[model samples]
Target: MNGNVTAPLSWVFTLVFVGFYVVAYQHSIHLWRWPYPRYILVALSFGMVLWLLVKMRFHLPWVTYWIEMADYAFLATLMYGYFKIQDKDRRIKDRLFQSANWDALTHVQNYAAYDRAIGYHFSRSLIRHNNLTMAMFDIDHFKCVNDTYGHLAGDEVLKQVSSTVVDVLKAKDEQIVLYRTGGEEFNVIFPGYTVAQAQPLVQEFFDRVKALRIPYNDVELNVTISVGVSSLHRTDHNPLDFYKRVDSHLYRSKKMGRQQITLE
Candidate 1:
């Protein structure tokens, strides 16, 4: 606190401190957040400049005349290293988050994320006495597509089916979220809609899907889906009890006939 801030020796020590802080800051990945690391780097850079300006007014020893420029070069090198680490960390986190939330094939939320979201919304709906509806659907005779057209074609069909469902239902309510629960099966959750209110929209969505005849490699692959709808009841207590009721209707839809909607 009492050193010659204008002295070249003082500038040398200050720059070294900045360098050490940078090393520690960049490596402290789990500890620091945005702007904290950036602020430290900025303050050090500004101090280096102000100290250099003051040192210019004083005569330096011949041996240390070039030391000021060397300090600047060293600081620049450390900053470059910091930037490299920051960029790498951002990319790694992006990939990790995307893989966790999204399905690789359909680009919709995966089962793990879907489970968490539905459970949270289900609890909130019960507490507020709000309408909560679930619809589960599966492609009718999906195995036939894989057997007849090959697995690659089946994968394409699955992606397109999910895409169509999203485009159709997302506009009805932005809060409505859909997920591919597993192969050939998908689930949609409507937070504030009763089962009856969702019927016409879902019927239209299935009709559009039933009308779809995708062409792949000189083969026209036609597909249809069966949907089962259920609403949350006062008796429901947990996610499993809630989901099983919805799943039962899906089984009924498949049983009555393929390519139909069953809401009981």
Candidate 2:
């Protein structure tokens, strides 16, 4: 009687342990990309199955076997439920992050994302002495467009201009990112590039915006942009200092002429 009870109990414990091991292995793979863990699990599972086969010669009662199987089924269901909940949680977090950081109208990074990225990059550049450039630009006569063509037209213009700029940056380099910082205003950050290196790209952006002909209703609308470019300065104390300097240069571009690039 003792041997009969012990045999079934041991099998039950082994199955429970295997169930836990499988759940842990799944979690580890989800968190990290590694192959060694998978191989190890396979080897262990094979060994466990062989050991179970050797123990299978014990003629256990049908009721005890059924009970052990039922226990394993319940445990497996719990593990699967937990894994699904974790996956769902991760997806929800990713979706929320995208909605928060991206502009709905232009489908680019929004001002909040700009604020976070600029600060992080600015600090990193100051520490590592890496090249960083910032460019601030806006539609030259954006208000006039909103007044004459209506807000919907203005929105379409913003969308098309942002798309054009994104395409230009993507062609030049993947590291360059554009942000919609304000109404009709956008900013670009060029990582690993100086003002001189970034100049031609900025000029290309200016020319492209100048050439854009957006159709709204029965009329076609033309747009021009004024840009100000600046690089990290030794005198800058914080990201705000860099931002102010670039903003002042943009003001200069607008003051000097409507459609041109200003750099310092």
Candidate 3:
């Protein structure tokens, strides 16, 4: 009688050990959605078949077989719940990251994102000796618009300008990113592009912004932007110097009169 009880108890203990082993192995591998439902189904079917063979060989009771199956089912349910929670946490992190990095008004990257990207790209460009160009531009007489119309109308103009620039950049190159650095001020980063190559694109942007006619409060308002474009120089020690150079060019454009592109 002891032998009979020991045989069934051993099988029960083995099944429980195997279940935990599989879960631990998957966790060690950092597997996502492991032990999926289909895998669990296959495992359950195989375990049932093996149990049947053992029952025939040892004359084990039906109660032993049912108890082992119940333990396997419980472990599978627990694993499924664990993966579900992980997936939900991943989504929440992604959403929070987006909210922090993107501009709430224009849907483009904000100044904080710009700061991080510029440093990263600048370092990469230095290491790889690749071309990188930056353009800084702002709306001309933007304050006049806000003064004459209203802040609401000024907001609409910003939205329209940002949308137009984003569309243009998307069509031209996927590697280029636009950022709203501040009020009515935007910047673009072009990886692997020289000043000569980026000039036409900047000019196209200038033409597009000049052509924008934003409708607000039953009145149509025309907008113009002054741009300063520059490429990376080997002499430059850091991204700030590169930025200052482009900013000077932009200042020159504004000084020379708005609605033009100044290339450096």
Candidate 4:
């Protein structure tokens, strides 16, 4: 048994070696479809077939069995290492994908994510002939807050506001997506709501924003936001058109007075 035995030196044994991976792939397919009994049967059948081939067909020497056992251990170790490396690569890829879509500061959806969401929703709405509402918002007197409180405080305020808004939106029944489209600006997509239907929810969001106060150092800072809403149009061709329409209402709200909502 301690001797080096090369039993699988022939073409027939090589084919059996290749058949292991083939059966492993079939096992994966069965597992994917939630057929537990079929998968287990296949696994048992594969083991029986391989064992029968090794024992009955290639009955060379007892030392061959021991050597083959060692070979299997080595292959198991190699496969474990390969799977570990693959898992690490997948985790790194996931982190990079998340960072690209999320704001580094506020942990909200960034502009890139916002752009993707717009295109996705636009395509879905165009296909289903559905209505989509967008609300574009900016912090009111944000410069004053930054200049008065300092940059660190500004960051804290942003974190607080974003967290607060996310909490409020999550409590509602309707599906809404939040995005930090600019430094002090955000965009929200309200799926399956018209401009009029989105008003009460948008107002609730503004009220929630007004309710949150951040305590930094000894001072408690208050933050308010101006919002503009627009419904999707049949004439619109692209995501940019939907953004422009909502942004126009936001511009008007900011021009008239800060900390208000305008719907168009």
Question: Candidate 2: where is the Cα deviation over 4 Å?
Answer: 1-65
Candidate 1 residue spans exceeding 4 A from truth: 1-70
lDDT of 1 by residue, 167-220 (tens): 888867788888888888899998889998888778878988888888899988
Q: Which 10 consecutive positions of candidate 4 have the poorest summed lDDT?
A: 1-10
lDDT winner: 3
How many clashes in each structure?
0, 0, 0, 0
The deviation in Å at residue 142 for candidate 1 is: 0.4
What candidate 4 gets wrong by more than 4 Å, as runs, is 1-65
Q: Which pairs of residues collide in model 2? A: none
Residues 75-118 of candidate 4: C-alpha lDDT, one tens digit per residue: 65566567658968999999999999999899998999888889
Residue range 41-108, candidate 2, lDDT tens digits? 55455444533444465565656555665565556556666866897999999999999999989999
- Cα TM-score per model: 0.74, 0.75, 0.73, 0.75
Report lDDT (CA) for all predictions: 0.82, 0.85, 0.86, 0.81
Model 4: lDDT to the true structure: 0.81
Candidate 1 local distance difference test against the native: 0.82
Output the better candidate (2/4) by lDDT: 2
* Model 1 RMSD, rounded to 1 decimal: 7.8
Residue 137 alpha-carbon offset, candidate 3, angstroms:
0.7
Ranked by TM-score, top first: 4, 2, 1, 3
Candidate with the larger TM-score of 2 and 3 = 2
